[model samples]
Target: MADGETIARERIERLESLAREAVAADEEDRARSYVRRARRVAERHRLRLPRSFERSTCDACDTYLRYGYNARSRTQSGHVVVTCDCGAQSRYPYE
Candidate 1:
């Protein structure tokens, strides 16, 4: 039987994929709900979100981010800045 940690991980992965599908389907509210659900699962399991998952979501608004849709990307200096529609900004450094 799968342990709680494994179950939580699976749920997180499922939620991530669902969020992507929701975004692709242009269901912004659904995508946001999925993101929030995944976050809750991770918190309950005492786990950190996957790096890709973390970067693909808005920390402030819990919105799943797509490059052109609800998100804008800009390169400044050595970092890539992603701005969500909610005006939340996150920076990732590029090599």
Candidate 2:
């Protein structure tokens, strides 16, 4: 492979590893950041990510769940119910 492709692959792998670590550490903010970075890398390479690249949505109210810098600043509580700035909430089975 070309040097650029190799570098992109390496960067994507590192970002994915970081994302997994952030999730395991229960650092939702950090995890979301890494996930976004990874997605960007994938897009740059014209590659497809395993999961949907779009933000998740709340079924009831149809609020788009934001991640990374776009996510709401509210601290998560006991469970993994993520809420968007639009006041829509949905639970995630992280644990």
RMSD, every candidate, angstroms: 1.7, 9.2
For all candidates in order, the CA lDDT equals: 0.95, 0.57
Clashing pairs in 2: none
Return the TM-score for candidate 2, rounded to 2 decimals: 0.49
lDDT of 2 by residue, 1-95 (tens): 78877787788677766765665666767766776776678779876554432335333433234465334533356446556655666554443
The CA lDDT at 1 in model 2 is: 70
Error (Å) of candidate 1 at residue 8 is: 0.7
lDDT per residue as tens, model 1, 1-95: 34999999999999999999999999989999999999999998899999999999999989899999889999999999999999999999999
Error of 1 at 89 (Å): 0.4
- Best-matching candidate per TM-score: 1
In model 2, which range of ten residues has the least summed lDDT? 55-64
Error of 2 at 70 (Å): 19
